[model samples]
Target: MGSRIWKSIAFVAPLSGLALLMGFGEQIDEGACSGTLAFEKSRQLLEERPEVLDIAPGSFRWEGDCRFAMQGYADVATAGAPSRRTFELLVALEPRSHRWQEVSFSMGD
Candidate 1:
């Protein structure tokens, strides 16, 4: 009985360890998306554009490893007037510097 229990533990131990490692990796990826770095980088890039007047608080979602998508409402300049519109930003982490970079941006109704 003791030998059988030992075998079971030996089989389960590596699997549990692997699961924990994977979970930890996922948490890190989520943090990168939800944390300030990704959002701030995206906001900065958007604000730099002349048509983007202002940006509101937005939500961030993980796209994949080191990539994030941010969506929110923005005040965009149209016909020399500011209009509220929805915007989306795709950002990715720079592997060399670990900084977020704007991949793409779009604004729509």
Candidate 2:
């Protein structure tokens, strides 16, 4: 009797926790990769040129209570008008620390 009640409580506790997470999940901005950089505006070029291959090279800092700074570069490669190739990049970072993990990406568009 008591054991069955405890088992039901254990199952209900995790379900409620998952429901809370679904209700208050973080909002992730599309195509935004932040790292440990001083100025975030510097990387605005990443959104401008989506057709080119983007290479993001950067690192992130971790503190005990979720304060950090991140920065990096986004490289874009595109074909030129006269059989030439062009490379464009945006380097950016934020002043305040955000709770995020560093990831390595090798995807192209």
Candidate 3:
């Protein structure tokens, strides 16, 4: 039983890793400085359909250790009350891949 379980784990781990690599690799089409992409992802994570108002110039910058930063404002109706929301966004990306993942998104920060 123990050997069978180990064999299963050995087979599954490589497949799981391969799936992850392919998933990330396939997202290479997402371009750099894609506020729209970030906004769309934020909407999903924030669980609100926020209207991204403006992406401020110079608001986007680089951070240490595979991180990038950006900030903007949007009109979001959270808890059923519409209000202007400020966002401090951080992301990670591969330079050539152009695929990005959100690291953190804070509204009103």
- Top candidate (lDDT): 1
| Candidate 1 vs candidate 3, TM-score winner | 1
Q: Candidate 3 lDDT, tens digit per residue, 1-109?
A: 9999999999999999999999876564434455565545544444432354333323666675556667666566556656676777777765777566778777772
* True lDDT of residue 91, candidate 3: 72
lDDT of 1 by residue, 17-106 (tens): 999899776554433434577777887888898887888857888788778788999998888668999988999987778778888888
How many clashes in each candidate?
0, 8, 0
CA-RMSD of model 3:
12.6
> Pairing residues by index, what is the TM-score of model 2?
0.29
TM-scores, in order shown? 0.61, 0.29, 0.41
Q: After superposition, how far is residue 19 of candidate 1 from its true place, in Å?
A: 33
Off by over 4 Å in 2: 29-82, 85-109
lDDT string for model 2 (1-109, tens) is 9999999999999999999998889867753543434223323333444653543536544332323333344445446532222232323233255323322223332
- Assess the local accuracy of residue 18 in candidate 1 as a C-alpha lDDT between 0 and 100: 96
Scored against the true structure, residue 69 in model 1 reaches a CA lDDT of 88
Judging by TM-score against the true structure, name the best candidate. 1
